[model samples]
Target: MAEVEEVLSHPLNNTDEAIKGTVKLVATPVGTALAYGSLVFMALLPIFYGALRSVRCAKSKNSSDMPETITSRDAARFPLIASCTLFGLYLFFKIFSQEYINLLLSMYFFLLGILALSHTLSPAMNRFFPVNFPNKQYQLLFTQDTGETKEEIVNYEFDTKDMVCLAFSSVVGVWYLLKKHWIANNLFGLAFALNGVELLHLNNVSTGCILLGGLFIYDVFWVFGTNVMVTVAKSFEAPIKLVFPQDLLEHGLEANNFAMLGLGDIVIPGIFIALLLRFDISLKKNTHTYFYTSFFAYIFGLALTIFVMHTFKHAQPALLYLVPACIGFPLLIALVKGEIAEMFRYEESPKEVSGDSNQEKKESEKKEN
Candidate 1:
């Protein structure tokens, strides 16, 4: 039990040591509650819708005939690529000096935060401004001194909404950059993560299962099996992780001591939530059973994560609890409904897209014949 406790405490201990005495606990439960609420709001609502729109646009661009959820082949291969990319980034961050890393990360967080926050406002903005505005083409040509070469730039003019969104984002980014306030930092991270979860997509149940299963083991191995994840989580300090105040016991600490849930904890579960939402739409059901069930499961899982963390006095791998809750609850519901097989076999089919692809294929085949 002592050994297990030590493992659980690894993340918090390292983070405390890393931050030094700069922070102390504020109002523990209240702060944490607010943080949890923020995460859920971003995961289920604005952030999610934004992600759906982006995915649809991307798929439409790739092949108008492609399915809304993408193909299983694509879904299955996503994790390997993501894992490799994350590991590589971890290595770079691990090797770089803190000063240099902060410099690079500053720009990245600023730009990404702007995009996330601005995109979140789009739906609301659409209500005030027209969804689609007329486009105007602008051409700019750059000529060398001798007029040897000319390059033309053609682009759509930024209209009322575009300028408003852009202006709003720029102001927010600039304010964060200059202020570097803790609240802004946390909010920026939330926006960026919300956008990420919103934009990510999955093809089907099997894909969500594959993703959650692989990450479940990955989270356990990293948090419990090795020191690497905790170490990385501690050493790296940026808005990529959301910090909630947790040490209310300390005197005069308004927001110093904090509990953190990294973007991974939020996004991994969020993607599954987004998947269920898409699934809800695909079924044409008047109600949203799977989506709501999964959403609540996430709430339960996160609560469990916090409970275990406080109970054990250590850092818990969130995905360890989250994976089972998110995946298991829905499966149980389906089984109870006598729809297990149907759920397992569920695949999104857009017949219009299929017809378009077939037509394209026939046209090419005729030319060949």
Candidate 2:
């Protein structure tokens, strides 16, 4: 994979040259069709499969029978569907503007239209003729067991934070446009002011080491560390219950012999982050938690922006283009976290699993009777 990436990176000596060629290709209608088609297949097909499977799992079985994790399909499918739809629209507009609808445009429209048809039809058909994947022997990652005989587990649901952020950002953008000023430009200006001081210090002959050392810490603690943690959290969301052996769980971390990771710490937090993003915010003062969490996410985003701009100072032009993402990603995260937090009290009592092995136990009997 590394070798392939290297070969692709400088196929004609530099990445810039490759990107320019790709951009020229994109500028043409035929090239746009080909590119969009390739991207759709590569990104969306698996997502569609996963979403289908997840929805199927939800409808067919009880909550206990469902996994506690979101499938990759669910995570990727919605985004891909939106992207493909946008691409199809762009293609339609291109064809409309052309002198004559070319063969490439015809083929692109047909294929995209077919994909849209299947995408729509599948869900409706699935409602009546639901596909099912039966309970298997082994578990997959990102799943949990409530350890109850009659337990029903459902797949993890989407977080509302992402939706709120999208809506809020859209509103803000529109407002700024109407006012003839962008909120993003203010953010960029603030970022520039903060970085300017660092730059002045770096220019001093004595502060060279200070700048390099700061960069090292920033990359290690902020960028790489955050990225790694986020990835691991994602892995924990699979259908398989992640666990450590009894010995390891009980004593390994504190004991001298060896060490192992804790299960709940990872799973709980990951689920929180997921749930945070899945929450939807309505227009009410009570729904303000999303705002706070979104703000928290923005802090990390700010850190990321600083790292990007600082690291690529030589390529300042390129770094400047990423300012929007720097602001967006953080705001998005904050929105989700706030929503999820609102659903629960700040002080939560720990949930307990029933200790009884059978459904006909004393506690169970008391409830049943």
Residue 211 lDDT, candidate 2, scale 0-100 = 25
- Model 1, 191-288: lDDT tens digits are 75656565555656888888778777777866767556666666554566765444434433354555566777676677777777666666687767
Note each model's CA RMSD in angstroms: 7.8, 23.2
Cα miss at 49, model 2 (Å)? 17
Give lDDT tens digits, candidate 2, residues 332-353.
5546656333443222111111
Clashing pairs in 1: 8-314, 8-315, 9-314, 24-257, 25-247, 51-198, 51-199
Error of model 2, residue 62, in angstroms: 8.2
The superposed Cα distance between candidate 2 and the true structure at residue 156, in angstroms, equals: 16
State TM-scores per candidate: 0.72, 0.22
